[model samples]
Target: MTSDTTRTEPVASPTDRLRRLVARTEVVLWDFDGPICRLFSGHPAPGVAGGLVDWLETRGLRGLLTEAERHTADPQVVLRAVDRAGLGRGVAAELEERLTQEELRATATAMPTAWADPLIRTWTALGVRLAVASNNSPRVIGAYLAGRGLADCFGPHIYGRDAALHRLKPDPYHLHRALNALTAAPAAALLIGDSPVDHEAARRAGVTFLGYARNARKARLLADAGARDVIGSLEPLLRVVRERGPGSAPRPQQHLPHH
Candidate 1:
């Protein structure tokens, strides 16, 4: 007689999940600020946000932002608030330009995320397409990539904030744009990011997401946000990629017809 108890399959470890994700990803959409490098590492976001607020005050438009928004450390918050208020094009353009200038300055001291460079290069060598899907300025992303001599890894496929501040992450506009440009379907792509907004955006875009957290708090945040594959470092991913051997290539997918 057979035993009545049923057997259960063991859950895949984090590294195994990462390996499976990497193996199936034909295109990688990367968030600029956190996963690539700390864009405001030395520059500090609070100072930048304060400067934007100060600029508005100088124009006697401090009343445009609520108290919470005025003090928020994210410059994008300020810009979005101003835009939502239906501020004219001149004000919005100037504010975006100012933020861009600040980002360009921050590039000089931006700290690279360890293992990010090699992972990008390795993925490129394996014939996986790469593009930057970020909320930061494309100009700033370009500068950072160029400085690291990894600009060619992404080419001109960097998508970021522009005049349309409303299209930022959590909106999925940039991710959609990258998918369209790369001619890849959502099912064949993966996005690696740090924030809940990034996870939400990827979910909307129908792309798989991997969370890259440098600390426990971030890992916890991602896990709480429903990210199943969160890693404290990119090293594990790098190890998996290296283990795939130099001759391996991305899994085959039917190319979407270019419009």
Candidate 2:
């Protein structure tokens, strides 16, 4: 007679988990607004969203947005709401362009996330592919990256939102595009993002996600979304990458088991 038994594996600490994730990541898909820089840090997102709402009101299209959407701090929320309102392409295009202009202006005062620039450069030097998979317009991403002198780091692999408002995060469209452009398997790519939508997008794309939570609230939000790895700062990741050294060979690609 044989007795039934079950074995449990030891849980990996957060640092160990991050090291393992970084070791296997051949490509990194970065979200723009948070992971790279706070695009609206100087312009302020609430004001930008309000400006868009005010613009729509001037055009007598205020009814297109629900009360909550009109008060949203995220411009994307307003854009998505307008897209779902069955508005004509002309209206959508104008709205998108307005938002794009605001993003462009915001880039003038965009605040880089701590240690982000150095980490990006270090990772690129270490032979890792990089791409910007963001909801911001590619034009804005390009302008900002160019200003930072990091354009060559991503080259043409910067994927962003277009007129198709439905393809944003939680849709996994951009992540898939980045993977295809880099010719990297999903298991070999990792996305560093700051939102639940980013986590969902990575999940759909079969890519690993590392949440960048800049505050306690953001950390809690990512944790609540079932993210297995969350960091309050990019410095830890930067340090880990440095310690891994330039000659560190990438581990074989394998799908990270979902928690």
Candidate 3:
């Protein structure tokens, strides 16, 4: 049975392995960026002038100028765009300060096409434990849950930066902490993420990884990261968890009647 749980790739033989593996995972740990709540915390959204401001080091118009040079290729036009955009109150400098590590993650965008309540509902009914384990700051993570009415699903038990400073994902520390808190064994916990970092963390922690490849590029990325099973959307994930609620011991084979 343990052998059957290792190969998670949806290939013919390994798919069987993945099935066993997923069946063994009873607890599910989810992330934000490409999985649940996508608020563009780390990088700026596309088409925004000086959008990648959070990554710049200089200050005031200096930072905006830097973002222009780094991203737009044409610094002159980039600066002009920034001026026209009027950036917001203290938006440019405060965004660049990188002061708290939390402020840098300052956006309010939800994962498009995601249905939090329905997904959480099914998992809850199945007795499966769920958690959010992203590196997103508490404020941003909270904002996401609040907007979606998902705060109740996680309560104060999620593992974002607000919960801990565990050097972020791909480290397994957050996952370890979550497992300890939930009182579930590592073998029984599953992690769903869009990045390879999440895959490495699961491998190190001996937890199952279900990669949600919301896009074509990410789908390939997750596959390359040793994802056991990859899906283009959350609905398939919901199906996996519901159809295969962690592997349980199969019923003992019946003995033939003595003839």
Candidate 4:
């Protein structure tokens, strides 16, 4: 006789895979600049970088940079160049301090990324340990989080730019520090970031990387960088949170005889 039993299993979709990833994640390492907020939105980053260059020029150190370095608006790149120029500890310290002060000044007008706040709160409510790993200064990050009332959510787990600009993302230094602080396995952590640098660092640290692309071009770039998954919106993640509730694992699949 033919069997007349049937079974149902969860059909995995993109969102399903994302949900599964989150369900297995013990910690979430967030990259501050894009994933969290546009920390340099209101205050133009190029202006800050230009200011750094001008400071060096004031000290008669303008010849220290190549024309390209002086023209670049990226502060981190400029800082790295300064370090590679072997400007000594005093110069590095001063530049880093100046950058930190500019970041702090920008924090007051930093623009929040859409859906990031809710997603963070949802993740926190689900008992996920959260940390910030970024190239920005920790003091600036702490200040921004405090302003957003998210300081207690992450506590002292915020990791950011250290003494050496060369040790930033794509080097896995900050990611390692965050992992150590959480005492969480790399396999059980998820990193959400916007740049390829973040992707590279996560790969080196053996953590699952989720690319948060704000635009189609950025999403394409992340995919080109070999990011397994890229998300342009957090709405799907929010939906998953509502469906699964908090601290719940994915339902196990079941099988039965076919008719």
Each model's TM-score, in the order given? Answer: 0.94, 0.92, 0.64, 0.87
lDDT of 2 by residue, 33-130 (tens): 99999999999999999999999999999988888998999999998987788787788889999999999999999999999999999998888889
The per-residue C-alpha lDDT of model 2 at residue 170 equals 86
lDDT of each: 0.91, 0.91, 0.59, 0.86
Q: On residues 218-239, what C-alpha lDDT tens digit does candidate 1 reach at each position?
A: 8888999999888888998989
Candidate 3 residue lDDT tens string, 139-164: 56666667777777776767764322
For model 1, how big is the CA root-mean-square deviation? 1.9
User: What lDDT does candidate 2 reach at residue 173?
Assistant: 90
List model 4 lDDT by residue over 217-244, tens digit each: 8898899899988889877877776676
* Candidate 2, run of 10 with poorest lDDT: 250-259
Best by TM-score: 1
True-vs-predicted CA distance for residue 108, candidate 4, Å: 0.8
Query: How far out, in Å, is residue 114 in model 1?
Result: 1.0
lDDT of 3 at 184: 70
The backbone clash count of each candidate, in order, is 0, 0, 5, 0
Question: In model 1, which regions exceed 4 Å deviation?
Answer: 1-3, 251-254, 257-259
Model 1 clash pairs are none
